[model samples]
Target: MQIFKKFSQLSIFYSEYVSFPYPHATTVKKAHKCTINHCLLHSHLVSSHASHKFVSSGGKPAGGEGDGAGAEMVGPQRPQFVLFGSSIVQLSYANGGWGAILSDVYARKADIVLRGYYGWNSRRAVQVLHQVFPKDAATQPSLVIVYFGGNDSMGPHSSGLGPHVPLPEYIEHMRSIAVHLQSLSDTTRVIFLSCPPVNEAKVREGVSGIFSELVRTNELCRQYSEACIELCQEVGVKVVDLWTAFQKRDDWLTACFTDGVHLSAEGSEIVVEEILKVLKGAEWEPSLHWKSMLTEFGDDSPYDLVAFDGKTTLNPSDWTFHRAIQWD
Candidate 1:
């Protein structure tokens, strides 16, 4: 039954991508360039793609026309790509864990920077944006990927977190970020990755009542992710549903997580795989063996034993567990 269900879903995904038109390669290339420009800008939120130079309206009038009326009007130019965020951008390097893998896969295919932090939240992300991207440089990125809300959902600040970042405030921040980028380049695309699920077991074992806190935190993260999607939609920004994709995989628990919070090497690979699928305009395909494995284990119960190459194995690490925290 599980095999049938898994195959059915894979069929649907394969069909969807196969039927849907692939985004133009040229367009994707252009978007990559734009993303680079935005990353270089750091925090100023200015558009690097702006072609027209703004002249001072206070200058003396030419002929009988007023100074403003005689001002030259510059036409729009081709769109560009931009990058934005926090330490995640830096994390794209080899030392940056999962981000490095993503960087290598997407390298040249798109211009992306991992502007994530070791421990940062939305507020901190905003601060980094302010510091890194200057007003003029902010506009070039055609595609912006946001991997945030994780740290925000945890830590001391968690108590003050809310369902939404106050609609008005959220809009204002998004507007400030988007308007500048749009002004620099009219066709920038912004994508926000929803926060992944927390390891409740780790919370139960490590900190008292923290597991419950994580549940509440995950819920809030979901809300924020939804809010971000809606906000992007309102302003014509593209959004990628990373949380849902991660949730669908069976290995997240065993292969990816190291301590129920951070991703292990294998776990990061799963994330990169999904990102690649999206960038390539592909869909998720659950392996037949993976589905069968899930059926054997059942939901909410850990796999006590694993089988490999015609032999039973006691070590869970031998198998590739999808979308769950690793025990070791």
Candidate 2:
């Protein structure tokens, strides 16, 4: 009852008031907002535990017996699918961010781990890969999606010259990442999302003052996108050519981008579609919908119980959510 109430409250909060801010906004501001939201969610989780009186396997009150002892088996652990990149990826959880869409589609199928940073380039990404994807199998992801190059393609003379990772170095960094990911798990698939084209005209026209003078142009972004495609090809990984995809559309500037850099909801939809295509090609499908387990009003039988920890039980009360329910 406590868990149900907690989820119900969260659901109401998100449906009524939650909204991720624009991606191109300052990182400090965005992060501050997210921090507040996280703190609230963490408090909710903690409070839920206090109210949840777990029943042990022997039908005894958990931690309510002698010595305040109790057994806790935090249910299942699902396959992890991680997204690693810069602000573009980081903003995916925003209203129109592709990452958010992916999270919705894969709600119970996989745990979507977001490792997106505000201004990270492939160089910075490479440095953090090991920390994000530890060698431990338990922590390693089943799928890794890498989206970078927006910051890497910035002109050397731009506001922060240090962010510009050279073309050759960019390509190499991508290659190294692919190799490292493959080494972690043979089954782990990697996909690279090439940078989308930037509209310099739009940026200069006072659309987004943040990147108005940033040295990133459509031409420069094209080069990085091509390099990403080539690197993926050479490494036998999948590549999504977002640059080409956006350019093929008319009025991409207004339709795809909120700012000159971050994607709008329309752009996010396109990204979600492209990623789904790749997933389909690999024969990936959504996990069984949770609703399937619900009994109808006239139903006389209970749903079969299954455990993610490789165990089977007839009691639905025994199921806990340690991990997510994954697609078969």
Candidate 3:
């Protein structure tokens, strides 16, 4: 499902040298790209015998037959949860990051897709909102976790070399991000993480040797966090106020961050907890919590378990336990 939306975006992304049409077809169009569009119900996929070289539209062969054995197109397999945000999210997979934790917790239940971009603020996120979460996705994600504001809250650099977006624009960008995700599908839930606090004593400016001032502070984070929560409340979207949450910890300043800006293992744990709190409390029809989602193939095959008697030898049929819960 996620791959379905990456078509044009990836094409544009690799437009420099590589180009292709069908995601499954053994075809290509370089300097170039595309000639086949497939639907899910089709019996066979696209291929090209004449122009496997990718000179023309080597669409699906007639009567479900292609030059070679038809490649099976990837079908919908599991629910997807996307983490979309700035640097915090980009680094969420390293050093016991929250995203990595979520992946571990949700194993076999769903796919947690990371769409983080470092050094990005609300303004940068707004520009790629459509590309990341296109309105025309064949299947929208079951959930999207959004975090953008910390960078935007940075004090405007004297030479305008920082990622400081005005307060008003930040609000609007966040609002748009939420609205777009909501519009993806009625069940496509969004959880926005507000700006987290920074250790004033440890944070510094002149990042990338580009700026020459103190451009980040807890005070600014507070304002952005407040605005984020207010906007979420107004639009009925779920929000995690990281600014207040971070400060609640007694050792937040020293224990929670690697450099007073990024989160450490302990801090990332808080994010995981807060997110679980929302997921557990929300009234989404099929819950996304690990416990709520049944395991994929149920328990081990009956053969793998201790058999006290001949009746316990169910073997392959015992795997049916996983089918107890249905997506609908």
Cα TM-score per model = 0.48, 0.63, 0.69
User: What's the lDDT for all of these models?
Assistant: 0.43, 0.64, 0.70
Off by over 4 Å in 3: 1-75, 205-211, 303-328
Alpha-carbon RMSD to native, per candidate: 22.8, 12.9, 17.6
> Candidates 1 and 3: which is better by TM-score?
3
lDDT of 3 at 256: 85
lDDT score of residue 230 within candidate 2: 88
Query: Candidate 2 local accuracy as lDDT?
Result: 0.64
The residue-level lDDT of candidate 2 at 96 comes to 57
Flag the better candidate by lDDT, 1 or 2: 2
- For residues 302-323, could you state the per-residue lDDT of candidate 3 as single tens digits? 2232232222211121121122
* Greater-TM-score candidate between 2 and 3: 3
Which numbered prediction scores highest in TM-score against the true structure?
Answer: 3
For model 2 the local lDDT of residue 276 reads: 70
lDDT of 3: 0.70
